[model samples]
Target: MIRFENVTKVYDPNARPALDAVNLEIDRGEFTFLVGASGSGKSTFLRLILKEDRATSGSVYVAGQNVANISSWRVPKLRRGIGVVFQDFRLLPQKNVFANVAFAMQVIGKSRSIIRETVPEVLKTVGLEGKERRMPHELSGGEQQRVAIARAVVNRPGILLADEPTGNLDPITSMGIMGVLDKINQNGTTVVMATHDDDIVNEMRKRVVELRNGVVVRDEARALYTSMIPVVGESRRMKDASDAEIDRAQGVQQ
Candidate 1:
């Protein structure tokens, strides 16, 4: 439900573009991972989709409309169809879990009765069912992140964008968060996550789109974090074998 055509984003005339001729398409109900080092244009790619930043050149289409063609006043409406989760878990400290999630619907002018019904259901989906009355500080890091995820999806957005979602949690906790995300994906939300955690990417074996210096170097289905192929079009069987070997080595180390 997202497409980018020769997209390039430049912040300064003297500096290099944050994204350089990047082309990508993410279909509905697909779970994809955007893996790269710092400054590899992952965040920039997301911002373009959200229209938080305008593309310096080319087009970005989300949910059938070109983001660049959307009027400024309509941006909010566009975002309502998309959910976003961040690494920091940006929960409201003063609000309890239920209120935090309900606020998302409230801001969109949803009735209190609807908010009351929806918030609890979403919290349950994120595994925070009984913790609704607790405030942000009262929850653990993973729980707080779950609250964030609940808030993001309360409106049933068509696409979910998670940027470094598990970056702050332990590996086990991160896996739990991934499980929550996977469930949401299965329920028909298209998921695009940007992450640097190799173990998580390798273990999940999802579609991976690797970026290097703002350019997409690899896009593979059921792929590992690291590519065994020195070149893009190498044998898939060889890559799978190499990934298996890497997993074994990691297991031995553990």
Candidate 2:
């Protein structure tokens, strides 16, 4: 439900583009991984999808609407259908787990009855059913992240954008978080995650879109983190469309 057509993003007129002529399409009910090194345009890709920034050139479409053309007043409406989880949990320190998740629906004007039902349901989904009253500091890192995930999905968003959701946790904890994300995808929310965790990527073997120097070098479907490929941030952009064609021919699914 997300498409980018020849998209380029340049923050400064004189500098190189953060994203250069990137073309991508993420279908509904699919989970994709945006894998790249720092400054490889992974975050920029996610931001464009979120409408946090506009592409310098080209179009960004989410859920069938061109994000560049959408009105600012409708940005919130657009975001309401999407959930976001970050590397940092970003939980409200002063609020308990239940209040943190409930706040998401409350801000959208959900009824108390709805909030009461959804908060607990989402917490349970994230495996935090009995820890509702715990403060942020009282929970472990993984638990805190679970609360953040619950908050993001409490509204039942159709798309979930996770930017390094497991970056700060241990391997075991990260696996737990990944399982939660997989479960969410199984429930039909399109999941696009940006990460550098090779173990996680290789283990999950999901669709991987590898970026290097702000360009897409590989888009491998149901692929492992193949060490045979160029290392992250070290791969140069394909010489031409033919290069990408070769990658696709090698079973790199869209």
Candidate 3:
């Protein structure tokens, strides 16, 4: 459902590319993990799929449409087919869980009846059926993230992109989030997640693509994390870059 052909993204003329000549493909219904240390181009990889940042060179196709060929006015329509969840949760503080999930459909001009029917279904899919009234601050970290997941999938997007979804949660909580993601993938949404959680990566034994300094060092259909790589400062730095990409995309849409 996703393909990148010799993609390279250079932020500055004087600096190296965030993603260098990376060619990858993710099939429909496949769950893949993009695992790498911070600054290894994981975030950049995800952003390219979202069209949040265009590759400096090459092509990115999502579900047969080349994102670079999609016009600015049509970006929202492109985004509607993909759901993105970030490490930050990115919830509206004042909005309750139901409103937050329902907001996605509302922005897309879904009918009140459709929203009413859809929101509860997705909430139940993410195991958040009874917590619709809870505000972001009122829920636990895992629960808040579940709400975020619910929001992402309410529209039943063809692809799900999660960036460090478990970075902020405890081990047990992270496992729970992974379970929810797995469930989503099983239900037939293509899932591509970028994460630094080695233990989770090793345990899940899914398709793994490891990037190092913008190069795809490893791509295995099934693999472990190989080693414990400590990327203490890089995670936050990469996340900041991803956040900036989101802000830029929103600014353009506005």
Candidate 4:
């Protein structure tokens, strides 16, 4: 569902690259986690896929569209179908829960006919149906995040990108959000989540991609994060740079 080939992202000419030649692929209906530290290029990698920032060189393709080289005219169309939830939970302060989720469809120019039929269904899916009339401040942190997730999945996009999604919540609330994501993944939307929550990562036991200093140190199928990392271990250091660089290089542009 997503592919990155030879992708590199250098923030400034002199600054170290945010994502150095990142190459990876995520399959449809898979729940994958990107585990990395604050400056480890996980956010940069997510932004590359979102086209919020372009790779300095290489290609990023989503749903087979070459995003690295995507035409300017079609960028909006590409994003309209994909759902993104950031660590901050970008919600409209004035909009209530239902309107917040419904607003996504409205902004995309989806018809009132469609909105009327879809909004409540998605709200129900995210377990926010009764709270639809309440304002953002009226909801708890977890509920507000669920509202964000409802908005994201309302359009039924095939891929979901979440960055630090459960960052602020307690463990139970965080797991609640994870459950929503897992449900969405099970229903066939692809999920690529980037997080630093070690407990959650260990408990989920999903595909794990570990990045350090903008390089992929580990990409293991059904992987477990054995240690707190980019600090993997001496054995990881012995792996060939070419093998590590191989992932960096697979992004659409690197």
Candidate 5:
């Protein structure tokens, strides 16, 4: 679970705040989408949760503890309960698939036997069972991203944060990645993803939080990419036709 109370983040005194007076909460086992244009504070919101960037004002709580109150020495421990995936698959080029996943556990002082047992299972979960020996360059774009997802969740983090996770892949591939993420959420890992793909958001119909100019404009459950407004005559018919097309696209992917 995560909560932000009247949070504001300012990088420079002369510039506007990246986030301003934003209060939001994400409950355990819920999947939420942070939707906005560029520079709309989506990434800043995530960094505050991770304590990668300190809030200029107000409080951020993760799992009931104020992230700002946590000591610098304990930040690593806090991050161990959260998993992060990025738009760019940040796989270690020199390390094969198995080692890349195992490294997360190893850095936390997990035993070799544990790493050996856990890495393969996670890789298989992400649909990479037979590719354990492959290098990052040898995998396709989607497969590389799957490897990144596997590495992030190998430790079974309580929360998963994905920032533009499907930005680099084709629609079909993005759907596949979303399927993997959905499976993780079903098992009770809270998922918060930031994305700009309208089709994906509209298809998933999850809780959507829209931000603009560092302010929360809309937060709705089972929402589409944007608010729909009433239209008249031919325009209404056109809108209905467009929605039908989107539904067809998603059906084909499924």
Candidate 6:
């Protein structure tokens, strides 16, 4: 489970806060979407959850552990339990699909035997079973994103955070990715995604949390990301790539 209680963040020492008094609870096995205009603290919220950035003030708990108070030595282990996918696919330029996914396992010190056996298995889960030898440049954008997903979940993480996961793909490809995420959630991983894709958000019909000016204005058990999404600053890059042009665009990352 992930819980944020009265969480707040202020990036600049002399600037205004980025996130203000956000409170939320995401139960295990549930799929949820975080919606907001750009600069509404959506990215900041994800960073806080991933511990990439600490809250200037407030409490955060993941899997019953307080993230705000976790030891520096334990941060990595905590991240291992949470997988994250960015807007841009972060595959290694020189690595093939197999190597990219196996990379995660190798990082936590998994034995070579397990790495050899487990990599292929996870690839199969994402429907990339036989393309292990293919490089990222050779795969479709959607396919490359799938490889990224495989890498993230290779650790069997209990929580998954995807920020604008489908922003770079077409509607059909977006659905494919969502299907995989839903499947993961079904298998008991908590999913928290930040996105502005109206169709996918509305179609999934999961929990929805909306933010405006860095504060949550709405929270619903079953909400759809529609025209109602808050429109904030540079965050309006929602239409960055249409499905037709997505394949031509390179992946982006945080």
TM-score of each: 0.91, 0.90, 0.88, 0.89, 0.89, 0.88
For residues 5-124, write the lDDT of model 3, one tens digit per residue: 999999987988899898999999999999877887999998888788999999999999899999999998889999999999999999999999999999999999999999999999
Consecutive 10-residue window with the lowest summed lDDT within model 1: 232-241
Candidate 1 lDDT by residue in tens digits, 68-154: 889999999999999999999998999999999999999999999999888999999999989999999999899999999999999
TM-score head-to-head 1 vs 3, winner: 1
C-alpha positional error of residue 122 in candidate 1 after TM-score superposition, expressed in Å? 0.5
Can you write out model 6's per-residue Cα lDDT over 1-254, one digit (the tens) per residue?
Answer: 98889998987868758888889888988898999767778899889988999987889899998897898999998999999998898999799999999888887999999999888988888889899999999999899989999899989999999999899999999999999888888888999999988899899999988776677767787776753566445434423322224445434421
In candidate 4, what are the lDDT values of residues 152-228, reduced to their tens digit? 99999999999999998999999999999999999999999999998888888899988877877778777776544
How many angstroms is residue 53 displaced in model 1 relative to the true structure, after the best TM-score fit? 0.4
Could you give candidate 5's per-residue lDDT for residues 114-157 as a string of tens digits? 99999999988889999999999999999999999998999999
The predictions' CA RMSDs to the true structure, in order, are 5.9, 6.8, 8.5, 6.7, 7.6, 7.5
Query: What are the Cα lDDT values of the candidates?
Result: 0.92, 0.90, 0.90, 0.86, 0.92, 0.86
User: Per-residue error at 8 for model 3, in Å?
Assistant: 0.4
Candidates, ranked, TM-score: 1, 2, 5, 4, 3, 6
Compared with the true structure, the alpha-carbon lDDT of candidate 4 equals 0.86
- How many residue pairs clash (N, CA or C atoms closer than 3 angstroms) in each of the candidate models, in the order given? 0, 0, 0, 28, 0, 2
Misplaced by over 4 Å in model 1 are 232-254
Candidate 6, TM-score vs. the true structure? 0.88
Give the C-alpha lDDT of model 5: 0.92
Backbone clashes in model 3, listed as residue pairs:
none
Better of 5 and 6 by TM-score: 5
Candidate 6 global Cα RMSD: 7.5
* True-structure Cα RMSD, model 1: 5.9
